[model samples]
Target: MRFEIMNAGKIQLCASLCMWLGIVTWTGNMKLHIWSVFVQQSYEGDVVFSVLNEQVNVSKGLRDGKTFSIRSPVTRKNAIEHRVFWSAWLDSLSTRVFGVEHERAWRKQVRDARVVVLEAGCGRPTNRLATFSDGTRACVRYGIDADQVLGETLSYYLAELLGISNLPPLALSKLNLSSEQWASVRGHIEALEWSPNAIVSLTEFIPNVTGVFIPLHLRKQQGGLQLSPETVSNMTVTYLVELMQWSDLIIFDYLTANFDRIVSHIFSLQWDARVMERTTNNLLKTINGHLLFIDNEAGIVHGYRVLDLWERYHRLLLGSSCIFRRSTVRRISEMKRSGDSAKLLCELYRAREPLARELGSLSQEHALTLQNRIDVVYKHIQQCTDIM
Candidate 1:
């Protein structure tokens, strides 16, 4: 099965490249380079296209005036753990194909399990929790169309590739619910009856987690903690809020080209519901303070789709926001100095073959565009030396 999948993907990639080349010829300004890398005049100078043999080096220098203020929370222990997690994730991708095998086994195990809808999920998709025949429950995110399912599934693999541990294991599953069950929640779904059997994406459900939040000004007025504009600028306060997770998340968002994460949307908190209810502003203090990032389906489409140039880097990396932590900046800076930054990133992306093959609509061109964004991140990291 894997061999057939691999072969079919190669064929599709060849066909897509042929069509792309034809389009490029008609356009007369795009150049298809070696190593599946290409450039078009429309790209401006934002992306540098090169073959695999090409070496990219950005000089390290402190940019003027934007000094990072806070102490980094990415201690030696934390960095080691992150490194270990990344290594395990890469190995899983290369050998086990992580979610693929897990999903296969899980589906077979849950085949006889009863399914039930829990509630409407947070995003565009009508997501709900359903119980399996074995009395186990999983979060089911239905695809309005095949494309959305692909996006969600691909995002899960991409998150793993980036060493994001916040996400639970995900797999493709089919919901076997009665029509009446779906009808009860039909009003919440955009296309409840679009397809038969309702093909869905399943994620392992984590218990005891709640969305993080900032104290509302109104709440703060009633003796709640107030978050002044300068609060984020304060390094001590930022570090107290878990700077490592904050920085890692920002970098992850930049690489994935996801801009939906607003400052208002806080991180996920575990075991702190009581304290969270007390705080009206976006702040949380936990033992480890791990940030659980959900709804990653919004990424993997930055350069693939046509949008305004100004909207690029709509978040802090390219935007005017300076809310990122010093620890985050230091992590990237350390990588730049280590000289293994590009090599590590390239290895991490090497597992893209199986993932892209599964996502039928995601072409090699789109994959290359994602790499272009990663290249941009490499350049962006060079500016991080000035961070603190």
Candidate 2:
């Protein structure tokens, strides 16, 4: 028995040493290959060397049983090449999935048209299903507080700026009973006890939207959403379209720190282990296979305020996938480089909304936080690109 124990100990030590040597050899070869590619392709050597250093550290960590901070679905040698193709495919997609011109017209209509009716049937009691004089319908969110309205409105613009057309077109309105837009709904507004001059937001009411389920790949216990040529080739066109939108969804949520959707499900995993099987909150799918991100009232303002408690879950969701849309990454990179994300967002909001002064804007502190979050997301994407 003593001899057997000694032999087992020796075997374990030898196995560990072999693993370490294998990792070192692999790292050295990967560095050399990357360096050669940089030289041959005329790519910046400094960036290539930095990425190589990171890869070496990651290899060392793996050998020591340490997990990577950002996880990738593709772990094969051709992952970087696969990622390039995937990003190009995403970038090649039309940015007008929701019809940018139509959305602009819809916003104008929603903002200018008269509100003919207000009913209590648009998901929540505070949100009214409204009819405009032009016979168009909208969901009017009479935010419980100013922050909620600000969050929803600004989040929409942020998505727009990022070239993500998932959120419906939004316009701001005030609860003035004397205004031509709200005069017809005065009785209903008064009955609801809404204060005069309270700012609210109106979103285009999408018909025939169904709840979206978390994809099996994202719900897996091990890792989330692998991106590779082999994996993508097996996917049906519809699945691919939805996954493409989902990639944007993840990035948007991470930047906004919006925990009311996937992050909430992750948080629920502590108690309801099967929570991921359910439909995602605030996510809806059109019959044509486009995803609509709804109820963004929790995104920027409230989401940032509660970041202290929810940031880990936010990071967990953000770090799950290595793939992202190319256009989205470009926008993020630009914002990070310019350091004007918050300023740009605010300017867009104020310019578009006529009652911007009444509604107010993001505080200086929150604006700074928003910029910082953008920087963090940019860095994470850079790290992901390097690893891939």
Clashing pairs in 2: none
Best by lDDT: 2
Give residue 8's error in model 1 in angstroms: 69
Output the TM-score of candidate 2.
0.77
Candidate 1 lDDT trough over 10 residues, lowest sum: 58-67
Worst 10 residues of 2 by lDDT: 32-41
lDDT measured at residue 364 in model 2 versus the true structure, 0 to 100? 91
RMSD of each: 21.4, 17.2
Error of 1 at 31 (Å): 68
Superposed on all Cα atoms, model 2 deviates from the true structure by an RMSD in Å of 17.2
lDDT of 1 by residue, 201-267 (tens): 6666555555555333212313222223233233332343343344455566665555445322222
| Number of backbone clashes in candidate 1 | 12
lDDT of 2 by residue, 164-184 (tens): 988888889878789899999
Over all chains combined, what TM-score does candidate 1 have? 0.48
Off by over 4 Å in 2: 1-87, 90-95
